[model samples]
Target chain A: MGAGLTLRLRNELSEIRRLTAALDAFAEDEAIPSDVAMRMALVLDELLTNTIEYGYPDEVPGEIGIEAKRDGDMLMISVTDDARPFDPRKAPRPDLEQSVEDRRVGGLGLHLINTMADVDYARINGRNLVTLRLLVTSDGDGDPVAVAT
Target chain B: MSDAGNQVQATIGSEWVDDVLVLKPSGRVDSNNAGSAEAMILGQVDGGAQRIVLDMAELDYVSSAGLRVLLVTAKRLRQTGGRMALCQLRPNVHEVLEVSGFLAILTVCDGREAAIGEVTKT
Candidate 1:
């Protein structure tokens, strides 16, 4: 597994894509389905976008390290960011059932991430670590198709 | 950021064929400078280029900010009883539009000719 990505919001978007592609390549090597790989990419993009937007809003440079490994049937994608320790699990989930006008905008990113992946959160050594586990199945039979990330 | 030195570029070309206004856009549109792109296209609408056909054949990527501008443009055109169509979207951008539900709302065509035909037929 490779180590960190220096946190610069401007270039983080492309880095997220790069990391996702690397993980997808790994998944393909393991014979993971194409559909599942695409979903994982979308989830990772939304999560990284959130970290760039909210995690370090002040634009203070930080580092985001993405590590991926296969654990049984699940592909674990962990993102570690050295920003202010804020647990996304504690953040209020958006009310998806509500009308768009009534619903809040900011929480949708986290809500999508939680709904799409098996999310685990922790604050380790002054860094926020978010682990997202996606089940790789030949047959698509897990969670419902989430709102676009 | 100065708009002049910015790398983001947008060109809007309009032509009327059978009462349909076709607007072709080329280059990137992102957070850095979607304002000019928005203004150029929306300005055409303001200048009586109704029933607009947006040829996104050359467009590479569009960020959320760019998407927002498109949404506003669509809403405005809808209110005025004018139509807007997007044609020949790149694969990556098509995915973004699909995910955002813009595919459901916007009229997407296979090519510029098809888009023009659709707008004129309606």
Candidate 2:
């Protein structure tokens, strides 16, 4: 398991703030680049926001867990939510060439994730599990340069 | 005593550069504060400031949630014949804007002066 950490959150949307701080600490302890940590926080925030907003329309409590494990140079991050059986990968990709007026407000979350990391989604035991693999660059022992590789 | 660690200190400073409104949002903008930030910017529009230049010099982090606010603001500006410019993006912020194709549609400049000039020009 590579000394992984799991963060469990309630269905409340405000809990995402705690999630960000936890992910940042995890990245720091794991020696991942700071910028990659920011990206991880962003994608995870997107997933949790969607689940909280759409997954529980009636404001009911639910389960959401995020697990991160360091596998060599790659960071394996997974988010499990007890939201509806919705697949984020199935969402339509926003056409980048579209004009400002033609562009839709949402749909950029998964698109941004797809550009930076490899993602795998599964519906297991009534939970949506989304795992992402991020290739990170390290700076030996000092501060890592904020560049994605 | 303070809700400091639990939340990113997202704040917007509003200034009027003649007809243009230069909004400086410091700290991080994500799902937590995007909606409120959007409303604050839109509030400026309601106050009759059409042109806007987002001074992102101090904005450390932005996500798709923040990007959505910019997109929404851009679309709203266009409907009213107003344009917006962004300047002084940190590398991380710039990369997010570039990867999401916002640089193509939004007027991004190297400095606040250039952004102000660009937004106020047309």
Candidate 3:
């Protein structure tokens, strides 16, 4: 499933939900674990929120595109946004050891994305591309299996 | 858009068994509308509502901003020796609370009566 939406916060969230729901449905139909589905959704949400907040911080009109596909036993979710060339994967990971009060609030979302999914990123032709891959398997005690594309 | 205009709706119910405040919220809660929800709950707390029950049955979604409101409200009520409880959480919202480790700190109930009973007993 895939969709492109404007960068407005309010409208973008709805679009994010819609795209996630579609991905969830696909996962369910393929008997993917609910936790995996939810995790994938969170990764998508974080990436899209980052794009809306920082990718277009100056309110320049932009577009965010989300695409999800099953490749082997893994679910690959990609989010692309057109703004200044910023690659999230290159950003330094937040220091989780610090106390919440002392920790910076902004970078936690990126940390969550990195920790939860196999995150990859690149800047291609002035657009930021982020791909998150999740290996799907049984709820417990199974080898990581990749879904065929 | 301004954060203040975020959509938030609240429904208050008076419980007969205990004079606790039961609030039901619907729509999205983000930085924009979190203040409204926080203000509503804080107002009830100030109005002598020692025991409060939040019926999240209709609450479809909440962001970090919304979570902050709940945390601050819980802390404030705790300072005054009051109690707050949440009930009937939708699956998605429940997942969020669980993932954030807030389920450990917050009193969650299975139903409205249980939530009321919990707050009153505290």
Best by lDDT: 2
DockQ of each: 0.11, 0.46, 0.12
**Of the candidates shown, which would achieve the greatest DockQ relative to the real structure?**
2
Where's the lowest-lDDT run of ten residues in candidate 2 chain A? Answer: A137-146
Span of 10 residues, lowest total lDDT, candidate 3 chain A: A2-11
Model 2 misplacement above 4 A: A138-149, B1-9
lDDT at residue B114 of model 2 (Cα atoms): 93
Reference-based lDDT, each prediction:
0.65, 0.82, 0.67
Candidate 3: stretches off by over 4 Å: A1-35, A84-115, A137-149, B1-17, B26-36, B46-48, B57-65, B88-92, B110-114
| Residues forming the 10-long window of minimal summed lDDT in candidate 3 chain B | B2-11
Candidate 1 docking DockQ: 0.11
lDDT of 1 by residue, B1-122 (tens): 22234434456556777667776666546544556778877887788767888888777555555675677788777667777888988765676666555677678998888888777774
Give the lowest summed-lDDT range of ten residues in model 2 chain B. Answer: B1-10
- Candidate 1 segments whose C-alpha is farther than 4 A from its true place: A1-17, A20-28, A86-112, A138-149, B1-48, B53-69, B79-81, B86-122
Q: Assess the local accuracy of residue B30 in candidate 1 as a C-alpha lDDT between 0 and 100.
A: 50
lDDT of 3 by residue, A103-145 (tens): 3444545655666688888888887888788887645311234
Best by TM-score: 2
Q: Which pairs in model 1 have colliding backbones?
A: A7-A62
TM-score of chain A of each: 0.75, 0.86, 0.75
